[model samples]
Target: MRGTLGIATVVLSSLMVGCGSNAELKTFTITGERIIVKMETQDRSSGVAENSSEDQLVANINAADEQEISVVITRNEGSTEEVTIASGTFTDDKIVLEGSVKQWPTPIDIYVSRGNEEPMKLHTALLDSETNPNFVLLDFESSDSEDRLILSGVSRMLGDDSDKFTISGDLSSIHDQNLSLAVAEVRITSENPKSISGLSVTELLLDDSKFLIEGIAGEPFLVAIGVSTFDYAYWGHVIVIVEPGAQIEISPSATSSSFVPGSFASPLLAKSQIDESLHRKVIESWQNSKKYLAKMDEYARAIEKAAQPITLNSDVLAVWDPYYVFKELQAIEFASLTSIAQSLEDPMASLLAMEIGALNWMEYSRKLENWYTLASVFEEDIVSRRVIPQQEALEKQLDVVTNAKTIVKGHSAPDFTLANLAGDEIALYDVLANNELVLLNFWASWCVPCIDKLPKLRELHSEYRNEGFEIVFVSIDDAYEDWKKGSEKHEVPGVNVGDLHGFLAETPVAYGVQSIPTEFLLNPSGTILDRDVTPEELESLLVDRFGDIPGSE
Candidate 1:
C-alpha cells in the first residue's frame, strides 16, 4: 500500500558485512569506474504490483552527485530475440536531460512472457550523455522523452459509494495550519447507506449538522456519534454501488431532486446479494477509516514539504512534492476510510477528500462544471447617471472548473495531427485499421517511466508488428525540432508521433487521461475495456488473450 513491499536498506555502516545471496536468485554487483549496476532476482513474481519501483534500480547512485544514470534491461519475452538495451531511469522524472540524448532519446518497454516460461526483458538505453541540471516536473503532454521529467507518478485515490464525498488537493496547507475548509453534504432520502464506488467519506450529511471527524480504523480514538443500528428491512445500510466511473445521486430531500435536471441513476446498481456484500465492505471501510486518523500529523508534514506551484499548458496549477504526495495518497487508499481520512487535520486529507468527491459528484460533490467554469457572467446594473462595467475573470473561473464528466472509453481514439522530426503529420484515428490493439502513449523524452520502458516497447512492436498490433508514441512538445532531436538521441525507432498539443486538455480531457506512461488497449472491435493497463502486463495480455489474431498481418 505504501509503495511496493520489497524493502531497501541503505548501507551506511561498513562493519555490517552481509552476504548478497537471495537463495532464489544469486545477486552480484558489477561496478564500473563511475557506475554500479546490481543484477538480482531471476524470477520476478507477476504478483508484484503494477509498479515494482525503479527507486533502487539495477544500479545504485552517488548520493552527493546527481549523475545521469541509465539502466539497460534486456528481457526475453518467450521469444528467441533478446530485448536489447533501452534507456531507463525512474529518476529521469527528476533530472533534466540534454544534448545528443535529448536529440535522440531512448524509449523503453517492459516485457512479460505468455505464462512463466520465459524471462521477460526490461531494456534501458545507455547513451553518451551529460549531467541534467533541472528538477523533473511532469509535462504530461510533452513531446520530449527524457530519461526523466519534472513531476512524476500517479495519484492514488479511491472511494466507496454511500452518498459521501472526499476532496483531493495540495494538503500541505495543513502543515502551516492554513487549511480550513468545510465538508459538503448531499442529503439522502433514506437513512440507509447508498453505494458508490471505491473511496470512503464522512457522513457529514447524516444529521444535517456537520461534526468534526477524527481517527481512521487503527487509530486511538473511536466513538460513534450516530446509532450503531442496522436496517433489516432492506439490506444493511447499503445501496447498490455505482459503476467504474458513474455518479450516485441520493437526494437529501425528495423535493431537492426537482432542482436538479435528469434522473439520478448509479452505474453500480447491483443485485440484492451484491448490495449485502457491499454493505459489509462499507462497514469494514468505515471502521478502517476511524483507525487511520491517528497519524494525521505525519501525513500533514509530508504534504507541506512537497508542494510547489507550476504552470502547465499556460494553466497555473500547484504541483505537490512528488515523493511526499505519492506516499500520502497511498496511506489514505490503504487505510480504506474516506470519511476519517477527510477529517484529518492535514492537507493530504483534503486532497483525498477532494479526489473522492470528484469521483462521485452526484452524491459527494457539487459539479464545478456548471456551477463554476471558464464561462463568463455579466451582472450589469445602471447606477445613478453611470453604467457599472463587468469583465470576464477567465483565469479564476478556469481553475475551479472540474471537467469530470462521463467520457466514453473505446471508440476510435480522437484524431489529432502531431508532427515527426520532419514536421510531417500523423493522426490518431488513421492508425486504427483492423488492428486488434493500439497503444496510444503520451510521453516526453524526460519521463523516467517512458525512457525506462523504451526497449521493451521496441520489442513489443517488433514482435507484434507483423501481427496486426499497432502502437504510436505521441510527444506533447511545442517545438518539432526538439522533438526530433530527442527522438534521434533516444534511438526511438518505430511509429513515433509528436503532438504539439501541449497537454491535450481537450483530447485527454475528452478521454479522461490524467497520468502517463499510460497505455490504452482496445479489442479489434473496440469496446470499452478502457482497461487501465501498464506496459509489462500489456505485453503478456496480448500474447495470452488474442494468441495471434487470425488475419493479423
Candidate 2:
C-alpha cells in the first residue's frame, strides 16, 4: 500500500496586519524586533473533504474569530532550568511577540494555547543568528470531518537579511490510502513521539498520502501520522531535518513491523527512504547486525550457565574461562557491525557506528586508544551531522574510558569524601588506612543488577572483614528513603555512603562511572588493582588471595 503524494508548498510571506484591539495585543518587541505569529483556523464541520477550493479554505480562515489562543516563548539551555522570556495572547486572529534575546545557541520552546485545550509546544533553533528579528507563522486548522487538527508553520528572519534559510517539504507515506478514513487526527510532536509531551491522537489524515510540515533551516522535528482501526490507535512517526532554504522531499513508509501496535512508533525504526537503494542496504545491514546480537546473547547465556558452579578457588580458572568466550562473541559482533557500518551511508552508518562504539566501550573500556579510534569514526562525513545526539551521549561513555585510563592497574586510586548513612563524612583514604584492601562499589537502589549482586557482596564482606577487606557501597539513589531502605534490606556490610545526586554526583563523575554496579578494587597501598570486576571475579580474587573460604577449607 502506497500513500498518495501530496505537495505542501510553503511560501515565505510578509507580515500581515491583524484586526484586533490594541489592548488585546500582547507584543514581545525587543530592541524594535519582534516575531509575528499568525494562526489560520478552518472550520471543517460541513464534512467537506480536504480537497476543498483554496478560496473556500481562505474564507473559512477569515470567518473564524476571537479564538482564545496564548503563546509562550522559552529559552532552553539543555538544562533543568528553562526561562520563559516572552508570552502573549492570540486574540484578533494574531499574536505578535518581541524579545531582546539576540542569539539562541540551543533551541527555544514555542508553546501555543487554544481556548481551554492543551497547549501545543514545538522547538525552534536559531538558524541564522546574525539576523536581528525572526518570525514564525503557525497555521492551524481543525478537521471536524476527521476529528483531527492540521498544523503547519514557516519561520524566517524579518528583514532583508539574505543570510536567512528556509526548509519546505512534503511528506509521503507508504501506508494504504484507505487508512486516511481511519485517521482521527494529526498534530506536530517532538522528534520522539513517545516523548509526545501533550496529546496523542487516534487518527491522522492519510487520504492524500502526503502531509506538509515546515521547520527552521537546520532543525529536526517529528510528524506523527495516526491510524485508528479495530478499536486500536497507532502512531507512525517520521523525522525530518530541514536544510538551509531547501525543498527536500521525504518519503516515509510504514510496514506492519514499523508500528508499535497500540503505542507510538519511533521514526528511527520507521523505514524512511530518501534514497531507496541506500535505505534497503541499511535495513539489510541492520537486520544482519541484530542477528549477531542474538548470537552474542546466546553465547552470553551459555557462559553464565557454565560459570554458575564456581565455588572453589580451584574451579575459578575453568569456570571463569567462559569470559574469554563472551569477549570473543562481543568481538565478533563488534567487527560485524563495524564492517556493515563502514559499507553504509551517513545516518545508517552513523547508527551502526554508535552501536559498535557502545559495545567497544563496554567491553574494552580500559583501552583508551580504542575509545579514541571509535570517536574518530563518529567524526567522519555526514555521519557526524546525523548522529549529534548520539555523539553527545557518547561523552559520558568516553569520560568513563578516559577515567579508566588514568586509574588503571597499578595507578593510585583517587580519594573522595562521601557522607555515610549517619551523615558523617568518611574519606576514602581514611578507609584505606585500616583495611588491607578496599572494594569501592558504586550502586543505587533503583538498579536491579546492583541490588541482585548484594548477597554475594555481603557474603564476601562477612568472610573477609577479619582479613582486612572492606566493601564501600556508595548509593546513588536520588531519594534518601529508597537509599536507607535498600541499605537496611540488603544489610550491606562495611561502609555505606549515599551520593543522593545519582549520576550527577561529583564522586561518580570523578570515578568515571557511566553505569551502576561499577566496582573498583584497591590494594593495600591504595593502588588500583582492577575496576568493574564482576561479583564472581571478586569472589574468585578473594579466594585466591585469602587461600579459601573459611568454612570450605
Candidate 3:
C-alpha cells in the first residue's frame, strides 16, 4: 500500500494589540496520531521574571479521541532534560504544561508515542514573553507494513504585525517504494580504543536522518560522516557518495597511525563500488601523507623550540610560525596527491585530492582557490554535479581573503588618530615620522594573551628605545576606564591609546584585526613590513635590520 503525505502552513495572529500591552489568551487544537510542533520567536524578551503564581504561557495537547498516548518534552539547553507524560486514563489523555522561560531562544522538543511504537519528535524554540509566538505543527501516520510514512503540518505565527515565512513542498514522489533505500549502517572499531576513547558519529554535511537517494534531483549527495572523540580533538571520518540502497562498513586505524598533521582522510575501508585495490591505494595515500605531515610537524616543533620559552605571551607567534611551515609542506603534499589522483582510474583519487584541498583551506584562506579547483575536479570526475554546496561559500571566502590581504606586507598602513590616557590625540603617521620603527599592538585587558604579552612588550620597549624603535599600544577596550586601569597597572610603555570602539573601531577594522594580540611592524614610511609576528620574530627582524642596541649580548 502506498502512503499519503501532506503539509499545511498556518500563521496564528498576535494576542497583543500594541507594544508593552497585556497578552490575550490563545489556544490551538491538534488532531493526529503523531504530531511534531516547531515554534520560533522573532523578538521575544528573556528577562521576564519567573513567578509560579503569575500566568506566563500555557500549552495544552488534548487527545480528542480518548486514545492512550505518551508525550515527552526535551529541552535543548547545554544539559538536556526529558519530561515524559505517560498514557493513562481519560483524564490523563489531556496533557497541560505551563512554565516561564528565563532564557530567550530556548528550543524544546516534544515526542509523542503510542503503545510500544516509535515516538514522533516535534521541535520548537520558545521566547520568554508571550506577546507573540510562532509555531509549526507536523502530523504523521504510518502504515502497518512501515513501508510508507504520511506527514502533514500547519505553520502559524500569532499577531497581525508578525513576520511570516512560507515553505511548500511535495512528498508524493518520496513515498514511492522504489525510491526508498535502506541507509548504509556504518560500524566503526578503533584499532586502539584505549588511546582514543569516547567515540561518536556526526554527520558533517547532511542534517537529516532520512537519507533521500532518489526523487531529489541535484548532484549526488556526498555524505561525510565523522567519527571523532567526544571532545573532537582527534579525527576519524568516512566520505561516500553512495548509490541508492548501498551498505558499507568502516574500521578506522588508531589515531597514532591514521592522523595526518593537517588532514583528515576518508575511511573508505569497505563500500559497494570501492574495490580492494582502490581501498588499498586510499589507505596507502593516507599513510604516506602522515609521513610528510610528521616531517612538517617535526620542522614546526624545531622552529617552535628554537623560539625558546614558549609562554602564553608568545604562543600565538609560535603557533602561526609553524603554519607557514605547514603551508609550504602542504603544497608539496597537494602536488604529490593530485598526481596520484590523476593517475588512478578509480574515484578515490578525486576524494583524496578533495581532502588535501580541504585541509589546506582550513589553514590559509589563500588556499580557497586551490580548494575550489579540487572541488570542481571532484564534481566533474566523481559526482558530475556539485556534491558539496561550497561554490558560493568559496566565493564568499575569497572575498574575505581579498579583504585581509589589504594589510599584508608591502601595503601602506591605514592611519588613524586615537586618544591617549591623558586625552591627547596621537596619529599613526606622526609616530612613524618620529621613530624609525613602530609596532602597532592591538590589545584588550580581557584578552589573556594580550595581558600576558605586556611585560615582554615592556622589555622590548626598554631594549630598543635608544634605537628610535617604539611600540604603540592600541587598546580595543569598550571603556576608557578599563583601558586606563590596565595600562597603568601593567605600566605599558610608549604611546598608549584607546579606541573604545574595540573591534568596530575604524583603525583595527581597516587593519583586519579579527582577533586580539594582533601586531604589525611598520617602517618609518608607514609601509607594513610584517603582521602578527611573535616577539621573538619581531626581535629577529629588528636585529637583522639594525645592529643590536649598545647592550652587551
> Which has the greatest TM-score?
2
Better of 2 and 3 by lDDT: 2
lDDT (0 to 1) per candidate: 0.34, 0.48, 0.46
Compared with the true structure, the alpha-carbon lDDT of candidate 2 equals 0.48
Which is the winner by TM-score between candidate 1 and candidate 2?
A: 2
TM-score of each: 0.31, 0.35, 0.31
* Model 1 Cα lDDT, one tens digit per residue, 46-90: 423232222223233443444343434342323345443232333
Q: Find the number of clashing residue pairs for candidate 2.
A: 10
Rank candidates by TM-score, best first.
2, 3, 1
User: Which candidate leads the pack in lDDT?
Assistant: 2
Sort by lDDT, best first. 2, 3, 1
Q: Write model 3 residue lDDT over 1-553, tens digit each, in one string.
A: 1122222111111121132324443332232232321122222265222421112122333445334433322233233333322222223223333343333223233444444445444333223343222222222121212321222222222211211111111122221111111122222221111121111111111112122111111222233444332112233444443322223334332222222233432232223333443323543354346665465445535443433544666554544454565456556556655665454354444544444353443544544544455455443533333323334444544444455778889999888998899999999899999999999999987887988888777887888877889999999999988898778878889989988876756667777777889888999899998888888787787788677877624
Error of 2 at 21 (Å): 28
